[model samples]
Target: MSLIILASLVFLLMPIFLLLYIRSYNRHKKNHFLEKLNMQQKFESEMLQTRVEVQDQTMQSIATELHDNVGQLLSLTTLTLNSVNLNDAEKAKKKIDNSLSLVNKSIKELRELAKLLHGEQLVENGIGHAIHQEINWLNKTGAYELKINNQLLDVQVTSPDKDLIILRLLQEIINNIIKHAQAKHIQIDSYLEKNALHLRVRDNGVGFDPNEIKVKKSGMGLNSIYKRIEMINGKLALNSAPGEGTSISIEIPYP
Candidate 1:
């Protein structure tokens, strides 16, 4: 009779133990699910923020180009027109011809600026062309010698979000070079390798110690670049030294 009673107790406790185990497992599963959902939401938020920052930077660039390049050209044309004297036909003809030429140059510049104005449309065309457009704009500055090796140009694979992020990354890198790096030569290489897309930008600029930058938590938009790369499930390798230069390489899984 005692043995029977002990067996009954064991049987009763078995269900209770199983119920407790299941409840604990269910709670853990719920917590895991919530964590994944939160990470997804955070990624989406970062992507949106990056998009806005890139557009704002583009607009600022446009304003500067207009004021410095096209605007200056137009202002010169105005001054030339104002100086024209209708009293002297020969002199007036010469000034008019010069003004016409200036106006034509301004129109050409405006057309180029128009291309820049449609920043989103650039990515829509394709990442290759978008990249070419960016390099072209930077080349206009004539500040550095650029060596470009773009293997993805003719290879048509569309990843719009990644493209924008990559473009912005390039912009930030370039901005850093302009602001801090006093180097003169830049090389950019992009290609596909082992089902992954790779982009590398190197510059012969005054580079600082990466460890120092990490400790200081400043310069070259490093924090922003790392965050964006994380959001896209990409990896970044930065190489730099104090008088040597800086190189940034990014690798991402492709479409």
Candidate 2:
């Protein structure tokens, strides 16, 4: 009689226990889904911010080129034409030729600037081509000795969003080098291997202790780089020490 009572109690409680278990499971499932949605939103927000920064950087570059380079060339061309003496055929011919040369150079620079204006489109072409364009711009500065071994130029596969982020990361790195590295030699290597894309940048610059930067919690745009790398689920290895050059290696899964 006692066993029968116990069995009846168990049977009566089974539905309540099952209902509680289902409720707990559903709650956990909903929470997990919400957490994922939040992460996706955050990633999208960061991407938008990155895009804006890239565009701003491009515009700043364009403005500087127009003011410091193209502007100067055009001004020189105008001055040369104004100084021309029409009565002296030979001298006038020389001045005209000089002005023509300046004008041609100005046109060339404007053409290059036009290409830069289409920074977004450049990434669309392919990450490799985008990188090549960036390297070409850096080379034009002639401030550093650059050794480049970029193997992505012919690569047909591309991740549009990743490409843009990667380009911006490169830009930030180059900016740091220009502003603070005080180094003369820069070596960049990029390639694809074993289903991962690898980028390595080494600079012979006055390096700083990475620990110091970490302690201070700011410097060299390292924080931004780390966040972006995390956003892409990529990895970055940075090595540097006082009086020693800095080297950064990054690996990301390819599309």
lDDT of each: 0.88, 0.91
Q: In model 2, what lDDT does residue 215 have?
A: 66
Q: Taking the tens digit of each residue's C-alpha lDDT, what string does model 1 give over 1-255?
A: 999999999999999999999999999999999999999898788778878877897788788889988889899999989999999999999999998998999899888888888888888887788789889878888999999998888978889888888888888988899899998999999888998889999999988789877666566689888878877889989899999999999998885
Q: TM-score of predicted model 2? A: 0.96
At residue 226, candidate 1 shows an lDDT of 84
**Predicted structure 1, TM vs. truth:** 0.91
All candidates: TM-score: 0.91, 0.96
lDDT by residue for model 2 (1-255), tens? 999999999999999999999999999999999999999999899989988998998998889889988999999999999999999999999999999999999999999999999999999999998889889878877788999999999998999999999999899888988888899999999999998889899999998899877666468798898889878989988899888889989999986
- Predicted structure 1: lDDT: 0.88
Pairs that clash in candidate 1? none
lDDT of 2: 0.91
